[model samples]
Target: MLILGAHYRLAFTHSILAFSQVINAATHYQLDYPDLALILALVRGGSLARASQLLKVDVSTVFRAVRRLEAALGQQLFEKSRAGYLPTTLAQSLAEQAERAEQALEAARIGVEQGGEVISGIVRLTCTDSVLQGLLLPALAQFMPNYPALTLELSTSNDFANLSRRDADIALRLTRTPPEHLVGRRLADISYRVCASERYLQSVNTTDLASLTWIAPDDFLPDHPTVSWRRQTLPGVTPGYRCNSMLSVTELVRAGLGVAALPDFLIGDGLRPLGEPLHGYDTVLWLLTRPDCRALRSVVTLFDELGRALKLP
Candidate 1:
């Protein structure tokens, strides 16, 4: 009876050990470093062209790598549709794991480089094209050279990037309200003015704003605050030309094509103010950084410089 009991106990112990070994083997399976790199690059880039640029490889290479990964995984990582490569649940999980691995590697590298007193690292920033061209460019010129060891990656997009996913380290946004997840300072209250070229104004009745030809944002920017403001301020008025780009709208207005509500910063020597600044169309500028990133020396330094420079008078 004792021998029988001992045999049962030994079998149970062997089963447990086998289970642990299986888990360990699955978890520590030799990961293909190149495939991991490709996955991370594609996930971050959002498109093939962008991924190619990031990976310094051709589009075909990216396509081949993605196909190979999908085949090996025996599951579709991304949905290929008209909207482009939308990540599947599996892809998200894989990408997140890859990100963690990359972060660990970066931490190791930074740990090794800690001997240097200089604050040196990469900081990714995202903002609208207008902000990039008008506000951030000058600010970066001053801030970047001051930190010779730091590198900046600027991404321009009309829509907000997902900061929680580390899409960017910081964001410069114009909004009446900032996102709850982000931590930042309200930099300024931005306002837009009704403006047109002198020649354009002469061609229309400035006294009756509703009667003037206007250039406005197209369907692409359906939720543009100006669109609602225009509808309320000038009922029955439709724009003479529709464009997606604010810069293009300004140029069209300057070419005597139509009048537009141009932002205060963009109102320069060429345009003449027609009316008092529009109400209910004002938005505040915010310089935002993730809570986790605020402690990083490079992020804090750039945040301070931008805060000082972009703050409203």
Candidate 2:
């Protein structure tokens, strides 16, 4: 009886160990193929609502795919929140490679088909909201008209798109150096200034940068990306009103609520640009891609066209 019990215990232990191995493999194993990339793209697109609307699928379907993705990978891609699901650390890291691979495959297909080789796909592009509005919109309008067959999948988020994980096929980043092992170009300089509505400016406490309330990102968390950005750019300045929505911030600013740092593109008819830029700060927008697909004809065509379209000169 004791011998029998020992054998059963050993069997149970082996089963448990095997299960753990399977879980680990799903979480850490490198991902390949386009379906995973597409699902990942949808998740990266934004909130579940936004992703669903953009994907032109039911939110329930998106949720199902998300569940299946998690189940198959044996890992949680996002942390559940009342607002929506937020990506996890693992998701952030892995996203770049999947994005790059997806890009490579598409480029290969495009090259093949355009040269009598088979091809058809959508290109995933990631860029800042500011860049998308100010620059990319016009460029895309022109590019799309020419390539009626090609689809442009654009993802605009404050989060840095991970090129290595394949978070984006092409990314317009406001940084000098691209991620390690990726190829990129420092495209142009982006500048921002404190702006306010004339009505609001008239009622302000002062025109001086120091003596006024401000519209800024919420600083509830220490690691908040926007807070970090604000601190780096405007240290010692306190944010009077903090909110997450860019539209909200702009609307508040437009209502003459307070002076806020805004990009040149965000400066519209009702609002006005301050005399001086915020701390005289500027960021470089970079065009990034994986080294593997750098030489592909389709990739080259995109880079050449996009580069020309986004030219500063």
Task: TM-score each candidate.
Answer: 0.62, 0.56
RMSD of 2: 14.4
Tens-digit per-residue lDDT, 1-313, candidate 1:
1122343344334433433332224343333657667877878887888889989999999999899777765657778777667887666666766654554344434434553235555688888877777688887776676665566788876666557678898899888777888899998888888899988776677778888888998988776777878988787998999998777888888888889998787787879988787888888888998999988887898788889988767
Per-model tally of clashing residue pairs: 0, 14
On the 0 to 100 scale, the lDDT of residue 35 in model 1 is: 67
lDDT of each: 0.75, 0.64
Candidate 1: global Cα-lDDT?
Answer: 0.75
List, residue by residue over 19-90, the lDDT tens digit for candidate 2: 334335526644334335544665577577777776678888788877877777877878877867777766
Q: Which residue pairs come into collision in candidate 1?
A: none
Clash count for candidate 1 is: 0
lDDT at position 179, candidate 2:
69
- TM-score, model 2 to reference: 0.56
